[model samples]
Target: MALSVREQIADNSRIDILSAAARCFMDRGYAAASIDEVARSLGATKGRIYHHFPSKADLFAAVFRHGMDLNYEAVRPFIDLPGSALPRWRRMAMSHVLLMIDTKPFQRAVWIGVEMHLRGATTPEQRSVFNELIEYRHNYGMLFRNTLLQGREEGVFRFDDLSITNQLMFMTLNSPIFWYTPRVGETRSDVEGVAKKVVEYALGGLSKRREEGV
Candidate 1:
């Protein structure tokens, strides 16, 4: 069913809050990003944010979830196509990199959540949220993990450890969120160029068969 008018307004307000919070967290690390800053970015009061989110950590978690949703949407088409694993994986990985560049702020917020969890810096409530996010992440990783298995079985790929290779693959695909900055006169072509390079670099690491060239 479509959202009621009041529900639609509430949803829009929440999305605005999340978008501002994501950009705030991206430009400033979690330690420095505050609810007040997000509010300021939105040109609204902190109460507006608190009305939707109980705390800063909660807002961050919401952003992380939104980021993951974007990621799933980006590659799902490629993952679902009926074809050889090699081409499917290539398309998925390329789309992943393009998303990292297109939605840099949200993607960076994802990395910040990982860092906060690793450092044991999150509150008890935040830790619970992180645990749920980690499970989502694991499930997401398994999509690629399963593809790698298919590729290996077909003698089209080489890898000793699926988990490690999956991590390495993401590290390459996700690196653009860290190092990529839009040039002053950047265009869609520029973004595509960067994603193509990143996709090839990641595919290279998989060590596929000679006939199935990157």
Candidate 2:
């Protein structure tokens, strides 16, 4: 089926508005960003922005959701593969850190999330968007929990409480977002090495006696 020019333009305009809104939210924060600024950034009119997103809050929510979806998609394949949990965990952590470094939009969205949490969102929709991000975090936590359980069952890992272990693992894997930066001389391999070190440290205490030697 062939699409009309108007439909194609509309689709492109909606994507432009979403991208602009994401950048504005990251730069100015949700409460301070206006629809006009987003439209201007997209080189479009406020009417176009409003056509795609009823309000700025709605646009921000869309951005948040999009970011979460992206992260999940990146990690899903590694997490779901059949293997010992430790290897999969390492793969997932490496992929996640690399994605955060490579994808500027994801990085911006994460920064916006941090800002929103600190300042608190102004509207119900914004608050809901933040909560959804929290929920995504929780979902990641659950994946960690399952991995820990699988490792424990195989007598390959030891943990006192699945819940606490999950929290600590999540913290360790996600800490790159706060501390990682690309140095002038840094290579992709260097970033992956750091990610592997984090995974090893997180899993070291839980690993079986023999596996720890490796």
Could you tell me every candidate's TM-score relative to the true structure?
0.92, 0.73
- Consecutive 10-residue window with the lowest summed lDDT within model 2: 98-107
* Segments in model 2 whose C-alpha atoms lie over 4 Å from true places: 1-16, 104-133, 185-187, 205-214
Cα deviation at 161, candidate 2, in Å, is 2.7
Candidate 2 RMSD computed on C-alpha atoms after optimal superposition onto the true structure: 3.9
Write the residue-wise lDDT of candidate 1 on 107-142 in tens digits.
Answer: 999988888788888888667889999788778777
Residue range 1-214, candidate 2, lDDT tens digits:
8779999987777667767777787677656889999888877888877877887667776776666677787788877778787787777767766666555455576667756676765456567667777687568557656767888887778878877777677667666665776789988788778777877876776675674563
lDDT of 2: 0.72
